[model samples]
Target chain A: MSVDVLINEVGPRDGLQSQGKTLTVGQRAELIGALVDAGISAIEAGSFVSPKAVPQMAGTNELYALLPAAEHVAYSALVPNMRGYDLAVAAGARTVNVVLSATETMNQKNIRMSLEQTTSVCAEIMQRCRQDGINGQAYVAVAFSCPFEGETSQSVVRSLSDRMMEAGAGKVIIADTIGAANPRQVTGLMHDLVGSISAERLSCHFHDTRGMALANVLAALNEGVREFDSSIGGLGGCPFSPGASGNLATEDLALMLESMGMDIGFAAQRLVPVVRTAERLTGITLGGHSFRWLARQVESEEQGGGA
Target chain B: MSVDVLINEVGPRDGLQSQGKTLTVGQRAELIGALVDAGISAIEAGSFVSPKAVPQMAGTNELYALLPAAEHVAYSALVPNMRGYDLAVAAGARTVNVVLSATETMNQKNIRMSLEQTTSVCAEIMQRCRQDGINGQAYVAVAFSCPFEGETSQSVVRSLSDRMMEAGAGKVIIADTIGAANPRQVTGLMHDLVGSISAERLSCHFHDTRGMALANVLAALNEGVREFDSSIGGLGGCPFSPGASGNLATEDLALMLESMGMDIGFAAQRLVPVVRTAERLTGITLGGHSFRWLARQVESEEQGGGA
Candidate 1:
């Protein structure tokens, strides 16, 4: 059976935040515009965290102001707390993404909040989002494994997901923050998740640190997960994890899905120019494992045209 | 269910042949000895081709003389014709690997022989191998896609496989020589293969040209095909396909398989030293997509030990 998958482009927010080279708001807008032109419907355009903490995502509000409001595109931003949520709402963000760490140690390390404190903060933000007619998606970071606390159990993730849903989250994304997961782990965790949560409201965000991101995607697809988070040119990595690679490249994921006869709403080849632009702006060599192969295809095409 | 998988290391034969620097016979022996110590049972140690043709494989006879014939190890050599097969027998190779391309263009370009001529030669070699009481494994190169031929039909591969087996090949390896096959293509081809040929007599060799090798492995595993061909440090690309990456790394394959609860007879961590040696010898940057992750693990282990 043919499937239509939703690819949420997270390059502007998740990808840029971890990069060393910071792009200007105009560059971010250009990247987003290219992605929108390529038929990406959902875009995590920016995050509302403190500029002092993350300088790369500092001018997201200005980026939002400069962006064109496309008819089919849904722009979202990451909000860490109630203050950030207010700032996001003021910035004209219609959809907000909130992240809560799955482990207590991770919560302590990342945002310096206990699980109870984080849950209350998320619930308050979700409640405000509902009242303001804004969509809210909760991301459970380190859902698979944590670098500090080690193996995270599925039960912990499930309980956190349940609390987020109760707190008015419309969607929940399970993230492998450190990229330490295997396909069997994905199959086991997603099998349990699909039974408790509907596939419509569940998504997966994977890091390609261990080269299993696409394999994990195949595993999740077997469990009926249709929504995935990817970055253009594979531009993001966890700030806490040293020497880790970026997120799975959007071009690689798109290529695999299209090859499998699944429709992802955009032409995979159209993203090559976008990837090149990202590489130029960020000065980070972005491309997934299939980057060289895609570059070869482009080279061959140009030569063919020249001939 | 606990599954035992066979990992055939092909760095010496397949990897070295494509590399720029040629390792001495002593270095080749040392690499093979390390692999044997790491519990790799089957190894394509060398080829019996002319030194004038492939200088990298020169002095393989001397390497065989220096190697200690371990009880569990099987040292096989690639034999392209009757003369090469005779050399392999003289060198005390108990098992010989014979190759025939699936596409006509690949056969003509690679071996300078037509499909019919290659088949007859392979059948003749297999028949002699049977008389000599030696094991024979036939490799169907470019079984998935050929660089010269756009797409190779499964029917052609199937017919060639039938002919090779009829002529006394004990095992058959389906090779994606150009590393152009995706998971869906692997699933489709392997599904038919597993039904026609017993999984016991079938193996898969994949190159990582497009970064889908491990994903294709997962697809083949789902089809009950267990044996796979890997090279240390991910060495060995197709000599015919320029700009292509090496074969699937033995360390990466071992890591994924062991993590998935499959017993491959040894620890995946044991292959790191072998990979380092391969890098030093071939001077080709080895290691697959998970190279950084594996290196980090090694660092952590060393630090933990010092503490």
Candidate 2:
């Protein structure tokens, strides 16, 4: 891992897609604007999918047109299939991410396909990204544990990741779909992945379900993976996983990295206001586990008792 | 680190001592009994202090007598001075712990002693334990940060830990008195500590104030710490630190260690009800961040949905 790390904020996409209330395309742009102001360099802007399946992601093409500072920010979009990918590329999305579950049952439940079929579809999309010169990413969802299957096979994940890479995917993010990953599990799996794929092309997506997300992050960091996916104010959870909690909170991740003296570019203390803004936009009371302490720091600084 | 880790429950002492309400000796013993039934082996039963100073620890001597399974379970008490030490030994306490703050201002505010004076007193107590054939322990409180003093010196902590060991203390616990520790900080300090003093003779006490307690635990474990101090239901905080939250919750630590494939000597799922009993006893709502998921696991198991 380098001294500087990458923070990929996914609030506008992964976070909002699961919310009960759908945000207007305008309000979604406003949230992205606030994130850019908070110094988030990379973000998952929205998804290109059927509005009927995910109503919250309606009008993503319009939202992309209204995003702030297109020249400075690295904004990506999620695409479920070839049609979604075409729509995303047409909307001028330079980066696109795809999801492939490691287990057959999870693939059936999440996207209504078999594991093999999902892999084929994702592989085709990655090849298309290479042809189109788009920065392509793939998420190995439920990579650690499955609600339907107890423990996912590491060999299967490795093979799937290798196929994605061979198909021209730029990165593979190991996601804890049910947030059932432990540090030991992370260390064991990440050790294998980093050895096979090299660290620069790997990232991690964790949920705080069992409250081990940060610990798991440390484990992955120890294994040389740096880039991480998180949502502002810990905005979302898996719709299919019953006991799974929110995605690892952006402020918590930033605060931890800042505290460690690592460089993530943005000042974590400033993200407090962005969390409040996201809460207002979504009508969901949201805060990371460290929200209280982080707010107190911001308050103390406001009172001129600077840290 | 060993495959098996020791969970040192400090709820009855460090947890209760900071509470607003004081439980009767009988109530305290009942809480200890509940933890014992849940498979906790080592517990800080209470402190031998002036009742006027800390009313919650008023009947520690009486509580000691009512403890269950004296031979099977290991019970330790905190002693502030020679008088408290004499009382603890008189009450049949075989193990006693002493606290030494790592900062001067903390020592002044906590025990009305200078850091040098406090160290000397703790050294005397530890020496006394050696003469009396007792298992002696010392806590380097505020080893990470002091409330009045921002960041503590690592060299000072190392020196204090060394002195405690030299003074015949069986173990020295590195305490994050205000919960301002990060995993990187933990890794740096523990690397020094584990080198100076062997891992088997060291312990860690953390608070969840900034929500990185588990991450810090992982860092310490990486540096070979096998013993940790946590409280049931995250019962208490340092009465002196403004933003310091509760001690690391016993269930959270146990669950993380167990999930990491380590042997922590008990089923973490069994501690959910124990947290409930603690909340009822303390009249404060308490749960670790993972409490909801843990409770769900217990419920699933009760319904005979075997994992």
Candidate 3:
């Protein structure tokens, strides 16, 4: 199939999980509902992780129970191991995204497993996903650069990505966990990745830590990779990666894409209010320099001033 | 001369001028001193606008008097008109930057003059600069999009840029006053402008309000336009164009440029402390997602865990 751009809203999962605050299952359901209304067709609803580590993602099953099923929207949960996969499947999650690191150091630091062990665990999860008839999306975190292991090699990224693709995984997401990838690196790696793997079955997950998420997205877009993962108000920072910021703000990414004449279904204008809500919810102000300017443009237009 | 990169540090002038609370002369001098020590060769030290309109910039002459004279550092000030130019020259400013709007509505809102009137005034200022042997740079604010006039055409930008270049402007910096210009539009316009004008004589000042400043910079860099105006820690907002945040952060821009193997002298590692000091002085967050990440990277390396 041709590359069809997909925006996977990870607000409810990656966003809330990053913040120390925990929301009730009902709140996660409501946030998901808001996203569905906003025309986001795919969402990483929740992550099945140890509550000891991330309390916000504790009641993933309960949140899944509360989610309103829609025909168009594909809701997925992050499953780290076979146990997480089983739990996600039992919660009626049709899609499960398994994550592993390419480097031994990062794999050890993130999940206390070596690269080989992590890959083996992911293979088991992928087998479980295939047995349960659930679509498995594997993500190789720190595909670009790692805090524990700097300068993640493109060959390693490609090797792991190929492994996941062969292991009954329906798709793969390349994540720059530490936000260290520049445009040249992104363009070069993406060009190679897309040539080897179908860009349609690939997604790019970026952290805005280095302020290069949007630029990286543009690079991937040029390479014909359609799917992207962004958090509302840029609310998701990596727990393992110290000082790394959240994903790219959905509003900011949508604005850039829409301005470039790429038809992302979400309306960039409507997202300003939601970003304000997110800002109020979390005192951390998100977005690049243009957030307030675009807000003013929308506000002035509403006030009948063509600003 | 070989390819030289000019970084016009605007934090002191454009940044402090827009804030509600004005800094003392000592504090302003300290800020400039820090930037100069950090290897910024050109600093927009202050603006000679009216105290009533811009109270923060009232001590332009005081700041100029105390500035440490260095052979490499070129101190400039904003000159709105002939009176402003005279004040700037009297204050010992060797380089004065003049501002004029391309559209009539913006000109009316900004300085209460028609485009023709503004052009005539700018021409007089240019003639005075020529006679006085002072370098005058013209900034075409709202060159990409006008808040009051809506979409600003490329023809207007080209016309204004050509006139400014012809009128003794050593360099003409194009301001995205409302932060609405995307990569394609900026690239396309720069392509057109570069054909008529040397990229060396051009600079781009972009606001990150739409999260496209870095991408826009990448586009301009690819076009061979090296000179750029950025605020330290992303200080300053467009006072005339409300809701537009600070120009792209100097550290962020330097980080990208340095990583790309481009020889821009400002070190991204050294800029963090400068940003922290500025943020403390200004009482406004010098915000960027990458700031903390960079700090952590440094700290981790210090702890023997290289990032």
Candidate 4:
């Protein structure tokens, strides 16, 4: 049942950020604690960003401070710039994720920086992470299609990925931020990326906005890229992208992968309680495609011993 | 732009039959008319089952009578048995869909018959359709997993498919009736099915229960399946299967296929209005994965010339 795949849980960071209400430091720690209990080893706990800009992530450092460090568990934080990276490092973050949009328009809109400035910023972040002995994962946002820029060229994404790697990023995550990627586009990009960058160093981050996240995941899996970023209860969406939906639901992805006989290293049944906790905290009826079905299974189990 | 794929619209039959309120025959006809106008040619217009058994599908004949016939547009009806077949033919149905469960438990529960009895009934119905010069599509429901029986055997599905084809079924649709199929299972079954049956004579019907329907479609497409059954606005789910979600949303499928540059004949843009109409009629917000994104595109077009 060991399927050699890494499910990097991003719910604590990505899932909670876009919500209307913010979870207290204790509440965020509880959610992350539940995920670790459910056997999710890797978690993006929070981001080191301006509280004035993203107030939801204000107490990230305290949230991390309160967390119980465990064996086989890795915690990472998103660092937007040099200051964010410095803050993350000071907060005892051992791994940092730096993001830059793939297209010029998105880079400008999302980070208020030109593509050149964003890449330069990313390179500096990656170099700092390398110098500080922190694992650096760089993200190419809107890797498939930008909300403002119709289609992103593979060449552009490829060059940016190359630059991030050259600048000492340990891994690169290709993100369909707008959730607009289809399987074929995913295949085309992954096919090229896998050839140029080792599959071990490449991952996929997708939103379920267009309901193609899992499909795109399958495409990446076929290309031998095994690492993926998912959120609990299908939380997270790019605030800048109009009509964008949530991130690929962790429970949904777990169900598909487990059904396919891939050992995702966590019990899908165990994630149900985690999702329920998320729903209670967010006060949103949180679910992915498998949410209802899983709930039914849980109910059946309660009524009849097991699903 | 000419990618060959048959999108068999199943909204009128499958979509409506599962709703809380049944649309009037006039309302059903108008929906079908709108679909036809949107350039969808194959529609499962209604069912010929006992109205007492499935009151939602009552007055199907009248619904058919109200439909406008057009060149290249084929209207089919779901016929449960010889009686339903005869009724469908009398109502001028050119094509008929006969369904048989792949599992013994489902067969007994759904139709109050054993597997042997159901196949015999299907053979008789297929023979009748052949005699009446009607095209017949046989469905192997719960082909992947049954709610009561759990995992359905591939051999059981294979043998039933062979018998249906031998009994004069023009095509056999492999349905993940309870929406329990993942891509690997789909690929395994399709890999074997395609070897035994020509790809042209094989189609796939999937539900998005686990959000893997489109991924399953991708698997089938890789195995050379060009025909798919989709409900407009993701409107159908099996009433027998507790907590089952809707059929693979036509808009979602069309978006994926069309984005891959496949000529799905109809534009994804046109399906937006149809989905809006479906929402209006069902008194439910209907959408696929790309529903919100597509709606935004339509809105932008209205404001700024056209998309």
Top model number, TM-score: 2
DockQ ranking from best candidate downward? 4, 2, 1, 3
The sequence of per-residue lDDT tens digits that candidate 3 reaches over residues B20-44 is: 7789989999999888888888889
List, in the given order, the native-contact fraction of each candidate.
0.43, 0.61, 0.72, 0.74
TM-score of chain B of each: 0.95, 0.96, 0.94, 0.96
The candidate 1 chain A region of ten consecutive residues with least summed lDDT is A237-246
Rank candidates, TM-score, best first: 2, 4, 1, 3
Q: Give lDDT per model, in order.
A: 0.86, 0.91, 0.81, 0.88
Better of 1 and 4 by DockQ: 4
Q: Per-residue lDDT of A154-255 in model 1, one digit per residue for the tens? A: 999999898888888989999998888889899999989889988888999988887788888888988899999999878887443432456888988888
lDDT of 1 by residue, B102-175 (tens): 98888898878999999999999998888889999999999999888888999999888988888889999999
Q: Let me know the TM-score candidate 2 reaches against the reference structure.
A: 0.96
Candidate 3 — which residues are off by over 4 angstroms? A1-4, A49-55, A123-133, A238-244, A272-307, B1-5, B51-53, B127-133, B238-244, B294-307
Which runs of model 2 end up more than 4 angstroms from their true locations?
Answer: A1-3, A238-244, A305-307, B1-3, B238-245, B305-307
Please tell me the TM-score of chain A for candidate 1.
0.94
Mind giving the per-residue lDDT tens digits that candidate 3 earns over A53-86? 8888989999888887777888999988888888
- Classify candidate 4 by CAPRI docking class: medium
- Candidate 3 chain A, poorest ten consecutive residues by summed lDDT: A237-246
TM-score of each: 0.94, 0.96, 0.88, 0.95
Candidate 2 per-residue lDDT, tens place, B161-199, comes to 999999999999999988899999999999999999999
Stretches of candidate 1 off by over 4 Å are A1-3, A238-244, B1-3, B238-244
DockQ of 2: 0.55
